[model samples]
Structure formats: structure tokens, C-alpha cells
Target: MKLHHLEALVSVADAGSIRAAARLLQLSQAAVTKALRELESEQQLALLVRTAGGVSFTDVGYRLLQHARLVVGQIERASEELAKLRGDQAGKLAIAVTPLVMVTFLPETVSLFRKQMPAIQLEIFEGLTAVALPRLREGALDFGILALAAALTDQEFDIEPLFAYESRAMARRGHPSAGKHSLHDLLDQNWAVNFTPASYESLMQDLFWQHGAKIAPARLHSTHSYSLMLELVRYSDMLTVAPEPLLLTESMRNWAQPLRLDEQFGTRRVSVISLRNTMRSQAAMCFVDCLRKVIRTRSRSASEANRMLFDRLELLF
Candidate 1:
């Protein structure tokens, strides 16, 4: 089957409607349907079933989409390699990013990469772990950065552990618990939580529950945006859990108070994830290498500092 037919199937599966897929690909709805029929005929298997919700993939259709992604990725990688061999570091890259890490991390990384390799083209799409992982598998993104574990059951992805960071409870600068170190003291106040149920939000709640503590539904619940949560903290005594990297920014430091728990909650691993079976595109490899270098440098320094701090604490003890 033609690559366009595969592209149509993947786009339909992702967009979840023939109309939506047609809009995305700038094609007529009839054209999209024809493409699907062509793909099914070539594969001798049905790829999609239409229902009230839209076009959904059949079991065989899902498997075909996976193979299609690999094929398309290989074609792109071959082009990138040829470009590199011609001494031109030129190709397009698509990245899926989350807001917490996306704020300063990716912009800085992309800027630096562009300075060194001016010919490279870049595109960034903001999405959460739930949405980004599927797109990465469908060959919609060259790489993804997510704050979840590596063992994804449905997708064949290679995860490179970047760094582990801790999430802490944050409040206003002069809040009651600003000087407090006890978890009990903080929980007594109204909460400003940063997640929804059955996802990141629920995961945060579960982490605390696992540690024998529980929080009531927040007076305010948030997604990933810290600015809104920071505003809530400033105006009221609301406390929300925030990743250290995001909270440590200078903008929030003046008004934000970090509340330390006796037991660490919300320790998360961030990683650079890519499809395993796809041919490694030159642009993809270069970007991954840049991420690894950045992580290694930061982690090594952090490790050394930790060792030194431990040695000093032992002496005092």
C-alpha cells in the first residue's frame, strides 16, 4: 500500500473522525474514506469501524498503523541520513513536551541546538503524557519528554532516563506553614492541588495515600499551569504540590513557600522517549544526544554535591 494510505489511517485514528482527519490533512471527507478503503483492500483486513463517536481502529487496524509508523519513520530517517552525508545538518524535528519542562527547558535546548546546527528545522507541540505517547508511537513526533515510567505496554518506545526530581507542597511566602516542617501542620490548611482524578491528579493523591496520608479534594484543582496556582496561593492560604524545578523559578520564589514533608511524596522520573523500531533519524539522534549530555552534566554535579553534603553531615553527627 502507498504511504499516503497509511498516513490517512493513522490520522483518522488520531483525530477520531473522518471529518476531523480530513480537516487536518486538508482533504475531502470522501477522499479520506477512499484512502481507508484502498488501505484495507491492499492489507486484506479492515482498519477502521465507524460509530457515533467517529472512526475507531479495529484490532488489525491498530497493528497496521504501528507498522505504517515504522515504515514512514524509516523513510524520513533515510532522507535525514542522506542530508547529513552531504554535510548538511538539515531536517525537520517534531517534539512533544509538557508545560512544566517545556517552559524553559525545551526552548533553551532548541535555541542551543539551532545555534550549532542552523540548517535544522524544529517544531514543538505541547501535550500531556496521555496524549503525547500515542502520537509518538504513530510517528507524529520524533521525540517526547514525559514524567512517567518507561514500561509502556502498548507502544514500543526507548526511554532514556534524564533526571529525577522531587515535587513539594508550595504556598505563599508569608503563609502559616512557611516556617513549618511538619506534614500535619500543612494538611490542616485548605489545599490547592494540581491534577484531575484518574490521571496525574489521582496519581498525586495516591502517592500521599500510599504514604499513609490523605488529602481532601482541593479547594482548587489545577492541570500543569503553576502561574494560576501561584496566584491562588498568594491570595489565600491554599497549598499545592509542585515540582521543584518548576517552583524554584525566581518569579515564584518571592511569593511561594515550599513546605517540606517528613516523607518525600511525588518523586518523578523524566525521560527522552522515542519509538524503538523506527530507523534512528540523524536529527532525532542528535537531539537525543543533546538531551543526554545536558542530563549527564547536571546529574553529575548534583551527585557530587550530594556526596559532599553527606560527608559534612557525617562529620557533624
Candidate 2:
């Protein structure tokens, strides 16, 4: 019913218990309990069910909690927006980016952004499209730098393609799959895949089939952590499909190299994805501009650079 009501509800869901939720909200346990009761009384529905361990949302509770998260996130962003507009130069932004972006030009991008708005807060999550989409929908992220094939046609998002990069099958330098110029050489090796938006297995299958090679890896491990996926490949015989430029880093280059296949993997565009029709705050736009500037400075795109996208976006903001 009220901002605190929604905040209380969302906090409980995240913290898992009344006392912990109270701590998170910086309110007393009794205050949080009263707020929850007030919200329930007004809604004429029970939003949470008690459990010995903590609390779990009922089916209806769970459904409403999603809305609660969206509302709370909006309130927070709105506050940040108001502050930035007032020339306070203080705001918060959260974004999810792929491992490639996280390790690559992001450092330079952040440096550029912070110089202009040093007080702006940043929360950066290293993740793929699979991890980013849910958070973006919930209003938890201002935008996401996600790896996607082709241009985005999804009506749910406003996609701004930044640059193109290739994915490669990588393994430890001396791994049997390395230096092999044929896809068939990888058929018998172990494989690990980082969690991407689409099913990596089916994607790989399509790749293999295109080349007239059928792959049945000795083992397949799907990992949530990109670092773990790389580590899996580095320490063991497991081969991983990751951004080709990932191996350009000193740490990765020391232990891993891309499989020298005759058939190069297709290029994927790394784009900024945000909820459709939603206008970003000024601070968010500044951050995006920094990304575009860095992309141009670094010249990372595999395809011919298109200045139109960047120019249009900057003019819009």
C-alpha cells in the first residue's frame, strides 16, 4: 500500500526471516512485523507463510512478491534519478555484463564514467544473458551488456548493439584438442559450457552439424561461473566455448588458447539490453555513452564499425 509496505515485503523475501529482514531494513523487528501486518490487512490477503526454518511465500505471496520487487526497485531508481537531476551527481546504477566485457574494456569505461560523476554508485554483475534477463525484468538492473547472435528482435527490450566478437573453443595450451584444425578432433574430448541465454548444447550441435562433424564429448559439464568454466578447462582436459578475446588476457593466455579449427565460430554482438519503452536515468545514459566511447577507442568490433548506433543513442540522451 505504501513504499515501506512494499519495501518491508521485498526485504523479508530477500533476507529470509523477520529479524534478518528488520536488520536489512534498518528497522526494529516489531516495526517490520507491524508493517507486514498493515500491508496484509490492506491487501486482504496473507502474503507470507511461516516456516520453522524461516518463511516461504505462498503461491499468491510469491506472485505478489515479484511486483513488490519491481516497485521497490523503481522507488530506489527514482530517488537516484531525482538526485542526479538536481546536480547532486549522486545516483546508483546496476548492470549485468558478460565475462568478456567484465574483464576487457569495462575498466576503462568505468574510469571514464567515474571521472564525470564520481559520486554515482555502481553495481556490476558478471553474468550472461541468461542471468541478466530476469534481473533486468525485475528492475534490478539499469541495463545489461549481453552477448547475442544477430540483432535483437525481442519486443521486451531496447537493444543497442555495441560491438561484435567471436566465440571460440578453448582448452589448456597442450590439451589434445588444441592445435587441431578440424571439428572432429574435438569429438572425443571433455567439454564445459558457460551458462548462456540459449542452450549451449544445441548451439554446439548446430555448429558441429554445419561442418559435417558429429561431436559426442567424453563428458559435458555445464557451469554457472564463467571463471569456473575456464578453470575447468585449464586444469583438466575439458574444452570450453567462450569469447575468443577471453584468451587474450595475460592470465588466460598463459594457460589456454583457442582451438585452431578451420571453421571459425560466428561473431556475436555484445549489446546493451534494457526493458522496452523505459527511459533510462541521466546517470545510466552517461554510463552507456562511456561504453560507446570505449568501444570506438578500442576498435573491438569484428564487423565494420557503425557509428550510427552510437551517434543516435548519444543524441537521444
Candidate 3:
């Protein structure tokens, strides 16, 4: 019936007990009980069934909980929007990013964004698209940069393609399999891969299978942290699959080398995605623009560097 009642209902459901919910809501147990009773009386529904251990939702209660989540989410978003209007130049911008983008242009983009919007607070969540996209939809993130298998529809999100990059096998320079020309050649060595969703793992496996080599699951080392993956490849004979741009980083350039394979490993499409109907704050818009500019500049620089390297190779030949 009231917002507090709804809050109490949701909190109780989450905490699984009246006592725990009271502690979470910072209220007395009696007050919480009174609120719940008032709410039930107003709605004329048995929302919860009490058990010896805790509580469980009734059929109608389960449905109401879903609506309650949306209502609470909307209220929170509204408060944030109002705060942004009041603070014009300052607000929080939350973005989720995949590891590839984090090691590529994100550092430069963040540095430039700080200079342009000194008052804005930036929060970054690092993960794969599967982990980030649900948060994006739930309004926990302003936007996200991730690799997608297919194009997103306008009805769900506004997506801007930042870049498309081919996945390459990389290892520390002078590794035994560095000179290998096919997946079959490296099948005996241990490998590292990003700990993404199952679909991504399948995609990687499919690539190897397409090349007539199937990587054994026991030989694969999966990690969620890029730094750990890099360290593993640098210190050990472990090989990893990564975007080519990631290998060009200053920290990785000297220590790692891309393995030239006889077959293509396929390209991934990375895009910046935001909820279509949501109103973005000024800080969010500024950050997105900065990201676009940085990616464009990096793309141009990479192209130029490649051209220079080709010219030198031609002279040597």
C-alpha cells in the first residue's frame, strides 16, 4: 500500500526472516510486523507464509515481488536523475567493460575524461558481456563495452560498434610453440583463456576444432583477471588467446609475441551498449564521447604503425 511497506516486503524476502529484515531496515521488529500487517490488510492478500526457519512468498507474493523490484529501481533512478539535475556539473557514471577494452584504450579514455570532467566520479566494472549486460538492463551500469555474437536490436539497447578485432594466440617471446603455424602444433602445450561465459568458451573450442585440433579441457587455464593471464604467459610456457591490440601494450609488447597460425581464429565485434530509453546524464554522455575519440585515435595509430613496419619489411626482403 505504501512505499515503506513495499520496501519492508522486499527486504524481508531478501533477508528471509522478520528479525533480519528489521535489522536491515533499521527498525524495531514490532514496527516491521505492523507495516507488513497493514500492507496485507490493505491489499487483502496473504503475501507471505511463515515457517519455523524463516518465510516464503505466496503465489501472489512472488508476482508482487517482481513488480516491487521494478518500482524500487525506478524510484532509485528518479532520485539519481534529480540529483544530477541539481548538481549540473557533477554526478556518478558507472560503466562495465570487458578485459580487452580495459587493456586497450580505456586507460587513455579515463585519463582524458578526468581532465574534462573533474567533478564527475567514474566507476568501472570489469567482466564479460554475459555478466555486464544483465547489470546494464537492471540500471546498475550506465553503459558497457563488450564483445557480442550478434547485433542488438534498437528495442533493447543503443549499440555503437567501437571496433572489430581478430583473436590471436599469444605467448612469451621465445616460447617453444611461438613459431607454430597451427593449433595442432600447440595442442601439447598448456593454454590460458579469459574466464567468460560458456558460449565464449565454446566459440574458442570451435575455432580449434575447425583447425582440426581439439584442445583438452585439462590443459586450459581460465582466469578472470587479465594481469594474471599475462603473468602466466610471461613466466611460463602458457599461451593465451587475446585481441591483437592487447599484445601491443607497452607492458606486454616486450614480453609477449603473437603466434602466427595457418588458419584465421575469427573476429569479435566489440560495441558500447546502453539502455535505449534511459536518459543519460551529462557525465555519462561525456564519457561515451571520450571513449569513441580514444578508440578512433588508437585505430589510426595502429594502422600507421603497421604501415611503417610493412615498409621496413619490404626493404629487408
Candidate 4:
């Protein structure tokens, strides 16, 4: 009848015994038994049957267990919502961000979120698209920021076009190839690559192939750290491909400069994805708005930087 009683039954069913459930729930064994008895009395059904081995859920108990999980989940969500309404921006916000965004935009986004809603807990996970999409559907992530493509299929997710930007190749600003007029001229140059089996990987590889250049296998293959990749390019003649916004950041630009490839190189759209069916709290909605703002500001900056860079060179492609 009560949430705690339902919790007790659910715990006992999961742990397979009263004593085990008590240990797991940090409640006394008698308390667990008493709660279960009360729940049964209120419901007027034998929820569990005791055997020498342990307690097993009766048919009604099994059905009640399913309902109990939903009830408990909703109750917990309500508690969080109520706390937020009471001037406490306290709830978990687990987001999956691509490696590039985590480096380029996440710092500013998180700083703004903390300033506006300090009590809310923030957790960010960085992986290429392969790792993030599956986790998004499994409820491991509350939302995701990833490149939009046909392969990222999730009917349960509501995908919004966050922004669009071009992906480009970059190297150290004063490197010998910086002034190169064509992608062919930089073929022999070492490149820093972060290749994974995702849309971004295919896009970069295709761009290179279009320019009649292949990624040099002997060059440095990098982990998904944009900062580290930029560092490598800054210290060496190595080139790496990055999203335009990332390469345009003032700090990021000091380390890596965009390489002008063929004119056919195109832009890609990044999307914000979240579960469609779930009811969102005010705090969750605010976080999503903050992310949109970050993307808009970053995208505008990238466009301005692209114009300035094009001024100094032909920007052939």
C-alpha cells in the first residue's frame, strides 16, 4: 500500500530472501518481514510463498513486482522534482558528448550550468558515436550530442538539429604545409588521426580520398582527446581533422590551423537527442537550453573564424 512496503517486496524478490533483502536495504530482517506482511494485508493477496529454499513471488506477486518498480521509479523522480521546486537544482544529468565537443564546448557549458544551477549534479561521458548511441537507448544516458546520420537510429529518442558546421583538416599554424595551396601538396606530411567506426570517421576518410590523399598509416593515431591531438600538431608537422568550431577556438587555433582541402568538402549537422516519452523536469529542460545556446555561440564564432581564415588563403575547397 505504501511506497516503503512496495520497496520491501521488490527488494526481497530481487535479493531472493528476507535476510538478503534486509542486508541489501540496510533494514532489519523483522522490519522487512513486517513490511511485506503489511503490504499483503493491504492488498488482500498472498504476494509471496515461502519454501525451504527461499521466498518466491506468487503470480500476483510477480505482477505487483512489475508495478512496484514503476511506482518506485516515479516516486524517486517526483522527489527530485519536488526538491528542485523547493529552490534546489538537485538531480542527475548524465550526458553523452562526442570527444570534440567535450573538449571544445563542454567547459563553457558546464561553467555556465554551474553558475546557474550549482546544486544539480553533472556527469559527462565522452566516446565516439558507436559507444554513445546504444547507451542512450539503454537509459544509461539522459541525453546525447552526436553527429546526425541515418545510422544513429533510435525511435525512442527525439533528435533536434543542434547546429551545423564543417569538418576540416588542420596543422600547426606556422608549419611548412600551412601555406600549401592543395591537399596533394601535404600528402607526405604526417597526420594525427582519431579514427573510429562512426560517421565522423567515414566523413574524414572520404574527404581525404576525394583530395587524392590517403591517411598516412605511419602517422600518429590518436586517442579521442582533441587537446592532446592539438598539442601534437603544435609541436610537430602533423595534421589532424576536426570540426570547424573546434579548430576556430582561439586556444585551439594557436595549436592547429585549418588545412584548405578541395572545394567539394561539405558541412555536417550535429544533433541533440533525448528520450521522447519521459516527462522532463524544469532543471533538465534548462540544461538542454544551455547546450543549445553553447552550440549557437560556438557555431557563429566558427563562421566568423572561417571568413577570416579564407581572407588569408584561397580556401579552395
TM-score of each: 0.68, 0.82, 0.71, 0.58
* Candidate 3 segments whose C-alpha is farther than 4 A from its true place: 1-74, 87-90, 149-156, 297-317
Candidate number achieving the greatest TM-score relative to the actual structure:
2
Q: Over the stretch 1-317, how does candidate 4's per-residue lDDT look in tens digits?
A: 88889889778876889999999899999999999999899889999998889899999998788677656655656788888778666687777887656765678888887888888787788745656775565455667877654345667778776555566777777888877777777778777765555544565555566666665556546546555666677886687766766754566756666777554455555677776776565656777777767755654465765455433221111
| Segments in model 2 whose C-alpha atoms lie over 4 Å from true places | 38-46, 179-188, 196-218, 262-265, 300-317
Q: Which stretch of 10 consecutive residues in model 1 shows the poorest summed lDDT?
A: 308-317
Better of 3 and 4 by lDDT: 3
lDDT of 3 by residue, 186-294 (tens): 8889887754554565656545766778777778777767677788989978988877766666668788888899877776667878878766666777887898787
Which ten contiguous residues of candidate 4 have the minimum total lDDT? 308-317
Give lDDT tens digits, candidate 1, residues 157-186: 777666556667777877767887766655
What local distance difference test score does each model get? 0.68, 0.76, 0.75, 0.69
TM-score, candidate number 1: 0.68
Clashing pairs in 3: none
lDDT of 2: 0.76
How many backbone clashes are present in model 2?
0
